[model samples]
Target: MSSKDEKNLTQVTDKISAMDEPRRSTMQRVHDVIMTAAPALKPRIWYGMPAYAASASAPALITLRNDERINLALTEKAPFRAAGGVDGQLMPAAWYLEDLDDATETRVAEIVRSVVG
Candidate 1:
């Protein structure tokens, strides 16, 4: 079983480790940020990706995707209040992440804090 076969991976770290490089490093960085920012969210494998949720019985609050791009997606359970929610306004629930610089890390931390709080 190769690491690329993420379906059978039940552990969060294993799944992230299995990914191909730059993606793998990016995912790992995101993983660290998420856990540090929102320690309440339990780490697990959800739909073959690294997912964080409130508990074993709760839905995932955030999920990371491993594709051509590293994707960060928030579930409906995440109370992420963006600057828009009006009739004609729209907010991005997901983002394709590349690098985790200081600014990006801060933003990610803020988002996870908001989600968990």
Candidate 2:
């Protein structure tokens, strides 16, 4: 990794480390899931939060932030197409996560994989 990328990773780690309770564990788990699902995505810090992107020059594909609730969001850069409402008219690009069970984690991994495509 480059020096700047290393610094960004450190900042993200610090941010995650500073979180309290379920947020910390949840973010860490989500981060792990994202990485495992899409190994090409590089982790970095964006807006003081953990973010992943194809490259530093590219827009972030995913970002994680935790406060009252944990948020896992896919950026506009991601191929966010979902088939639900009226021939895929309505789609969700972001999700609020409280915790991750096996099923939820698997779903999250699937989402990340789809986004990676």
Candidate 3:
């Protein structure tokens, strides 16, 4: 990893480390999954949130939305074309993860691979 990328990951780790309870634990799990599933996605702290993108120019394909529970956003960049609404309608591109069950984790891995591919 480049020094800049390392620095960004460090910042993201620090932010996640400082989070309170379940949020911290949840984000850590999400981080692990993303890092393992999509090694090419650069980890960074985006607007005080943890986000992963393929490159500096590309939009974040995965981000944490933990206002209440752990939520993973598979951004519009992915082949999950249903995003941003069907036939030009607008829609949210996030999924509320109650927990990382085996099936859910498997699906998440598949989605990450699809997005990265």
For candidate 3, the 10 contiguous residues with the lowest summed lDDT are 82-91
Which residue pairs collide, candidate 3? none
Candidate lDDT scores, in order, read 0.78, 0.84, 0.77
TM-score of 3: 0.80
After superposition, which runs of candidate 1 have C-alpha atoms over 4 Å from their true positions? 1-10, 80-82, 85-88
Clashes of each: 0, 0, 0
Least accurate 10 contiguous residues by lDDT in model 1: 1-10
Better of 2 and 3 by lDDT: 2
Candidate 1 vs candidate 2: which has greater TM-score? Answer: 2
- After aligning candidate 1 to the native by TM-score, how far in Å is the CA of 27 from where it should be? 0.7
Maximum-lDDT candidate: 2
| lDDT tens readout by residue for model 2, 10-50 | 87778898999778888888888998998888888878789
lDDT of 1: 0.78
- Cα TM-score per model: 0.82, 0.88, 0.80
Instruction: Rank the models by lDDT, top first.
Output: 2, 1, 3
* Residue runs of model 3 more than 4 Å from their true location after superposition: 83-92
lDDT tens string, model 1, 29-106?
999999899776777778878888887657889889888778888888877555564633565578787878889888
